[model samples]
Target chain A: MAHIQLPEGLPGIRGAMAFRPATARPLNDLVEILLHAPNSLTPAERELIATYVSSENDCYYCQTIHGAVAAASLNGDEALVKQVKHDFHNAAISEKLKTLLVIAGKVQRGGKHVTTEDVTAALAQGATDIEIHDTVLIAAAFCMFNRYVDGLATIQPRDEAMYRERGKWIARDGYVNVSKEYLPAEVAR
Target chain B: MPHIKLPEGFAGISSGFVYRPETAKPMRELAHVLLHEPSTLTPAERELIATYVSTQNDCYFCQTSHASAAAAHLANDWGLVEQVKHNYERAPVSEKLKALLTIAGKVQQGGKHVTSEDVAKAREQGATDLEIHDTVLIAAAFCMFNRYVDGLATWQPEDPEMYAKMGQHLATEGYLAPSIKA
Candidate 1:
């Protein structure tokens, strides 16, 4: 049972977001810009950062959905997604992404846990100032997103196939389109 | 020194936001809507939620500033704000607020930590669905806001009086107006 009276059939943040479009629009807009907006960081890399942070937070729904999205963006490399979640340090990824993942992990632990050394290392590994900034923002945002989904006890689908299908749509269509398509009629209020 | 070369004389999240106004615009707008806009939950109660979460995160700047804002709204009851921070259960507040704070505290720890019993407790205390929802958002959002401030290692003011004065302005001016005023 959902803690709050959310609409039927909507799961995770989608349900909660539909319940309150007033707050949802801005929150969704933020995600759209963070993940889908043009930047030096590839969409795949950004999704990986989100996936890694969601995994660290132990948010089952977010981790699964975003993991699938990251995998789809990386040419259907679902194993890489699992590897990154289990242990990105040992995963087959670029050195730069590895360093960014380190920073993202620290942000998940606590803000103060992110030290000057982390930034220095990322810089040494060729991460731009903007990439570092975005990584922290992504991690920080997911903390909020993960908590929002789980804090409300939103329903989460358990099937891997479901996440993969959603991930494919999100990768091709982006968040704005997916949100509009999936949003229920009454909840749009 | 901020990690990003934020403009001098700006401290904490302010400097960081100013550094990247593009991201800051929507964020500040969201805070304005969430904290200042009229709702079932009064601005004071909402500020208390922000302060509570910031305290949990141990972000000195956020806790101090928001504590002052909450105090100013509560007719300068600084001690009450401090009590909430030290121990909300012992503090003199509504049963509903106590239950909500319990939920907020759980959110600060981790989302999974919140249980069905916690929600039932809040609802039993007469917390509406919107109130419970907002409480969770406030707690969750503060996690982001706190991390934004502390993650960048921004400078924080040391004087409690400074926070008190800012709180006064914020109480009267509201978040959107005060953010522009200060």
Candidate 2:
């Protein structure tokens, strides 16, 4: 039901990337750095940020997929994921995380919405510069991702099971395996 | 000098928020849900996503403040911040985060750029459904934030020292602090 003429059975951004691998590589590379590189923040936390932003934008594909990913990583705790989506502050998280989410919310609305005080709260709660930097990046990046997915009118699966299954695979293989270069052209189609 | 005016000595989003407290509240509430709420992912990681997206969108205020916040909580490594901003893949992070950033980048450009495989890749890297959802939300929100700030032409301080100092203050006080709230 996407606005464009993408191949049938195409789920999310992957199909679009397959259609244009050249553009996909750089995009993939960027994700590798921001989400998977190496530092203090865990993968689960990073993914949560994406889900939070997607939910705000009402991008069904992103919200469902990331929600599944978060659930899988949290030992299949879908309820916690749902709770966070409904309300982060009330969710059982650390003070530092609460503060960071505050800032993330600001970023989602507009960078200018964030304040020095917001940064101060995170730091007080033990957030580091790198963590802060990454948070902003994550929020900023998702803005683009949401638009990209929603903009193209990509096919968003209605099945929650599909997302859970895919989340398991992602938790195991990482993004490279799913790359168009690795998958057969027909599967990509 | 910002293209728009509110009050003197104001900087970044806080300043703008102060000018219009009522309108800013909803946005703040939305950000709170997107970021602070717990899930499989950590707050630090979530903040990093926000910073990355802001940087991609060229939102100076967001890039600086969130970067500072991330640094304060996670690593406190300004170098890493610069590295991610310049090139995230080369930056020091984990495999899973790298995958998430990939999706975030696409979000910055447009959501259509993301793929099912992208979600799969992120999931393969241990990204959960909430993680993926948060990633998209972060990207989408930043777009709105970037445009909001840029559209209004909010104040942006050129001094790095100023931001560093501001970062320290922000690290100490929450966004709801009297200084920040209008």
Candidate 3:
């Protein structure tokens, strides 16, 4: 049960956006760019970053959903996702990613916390400028995302399986189509 | 002149870490994984995503530093960083990245804003599950980062030139080395 009044069967921020498609479209458009954009990092990696941050923020819905997506993408390697959530440094991943995640973590805390030395370490580990940029952006963007979802008091399913199912659909279709059924009639205005 | 009081001559997060090395190690380690780790997405692309998100959040320090870093890595394409900061969709980037940015933005606003279809769209644009996952994590993490910096009242430099200079050093030496006088 959510603390706020929200539509039934519609969990998380989707419910809020459905109530207002006028805002949803633009919002969706922005999401499209961040996740699917052609960059060096893979979609799964980006999602993992989100999951890790959500876990830290204690945004149950975001963490579960993204964790499922990451698990599914990593060939059902849900454990890796869990490892990252519990302790990213110990998680089985490349050094470069480790470096990037360190930066990401700092970004999660604050950009100022990110030092020139941090960038230097990442660069030494093979982090390009773009990677550093994306890491920061991902951290910055999720802050907004987490706040938006939590702020609206959206419903979050307690079942982990639910997120797994949702993640599969997301891995297949995309938010635009998933959002169609949730859109309110008044949104056309 | 910075609006806040950071320890004297702090080049980046690492210098702060040095002040308290024991606690800083974990934070630094996490950041390293998030930013430098190899993934399906290119480093440049990832940086751009971070820069754009920071810009949207209006975290001045993040926007400037990350933007400069992105600019440095993108072959002096500071314009792209600016464009993305202002409006990512209108910026020069791939369709896949554009889609990812959409998701990143949603994550920034709140994770629930992201939908299965958003992931699907990213896939359609050739985003793997990993890419999608990383995007979400990055966005979520940045939210924490923004709050931490703003929460602590960290200093933010106003000069664009300073950022550029910092970018050059970062591009060359990375985040761990401080070439600037601070």
**Who wins the DockQ comparison?**
1
Candidate 1 C-alpha lDDT tens digits along B78-180 = 8999999989999999889999999999999898788989999999998999999989988999999898888878888687767877788777776543352
Off by over 4 Å in 3: A1-4, A184-189, B1-182
Interface RMSD of 2: 12.4
What is the C-alpha RMSD, rounded to one decimal, of candidate 3?
A: 15.9
Instruction: Give lDDT: candidate 2, residue A10.
Output: 69
Writing each residue's lDDT as its tens digit, candidate 1 over A43-126 gives: 989999999999999999999999988998999999999999999999999999999999889989888888888888888989
For TM-score, candidate 2 versus 3, the one ahead is 2
For model 3, how does the per-residue alpha-carbon lDDT over A45-87 read when each residue is reduced to its tens digit? Answer: 8788878877876788878988887787788888999998889
Residue B107 of model 3, lDDT score? 70
Worst 10 residues of 2 chain B by lDDT: B173-182
Evaluation by TM-score, superior candidate among 1 and 2: 1
What digit string (tens of lDDT, one per residue) describes model 2 on residues A19-73? 4443354455545555555558876777787788788877888888888877777
At residue A97, candidate 1 shows an lDDT of 94
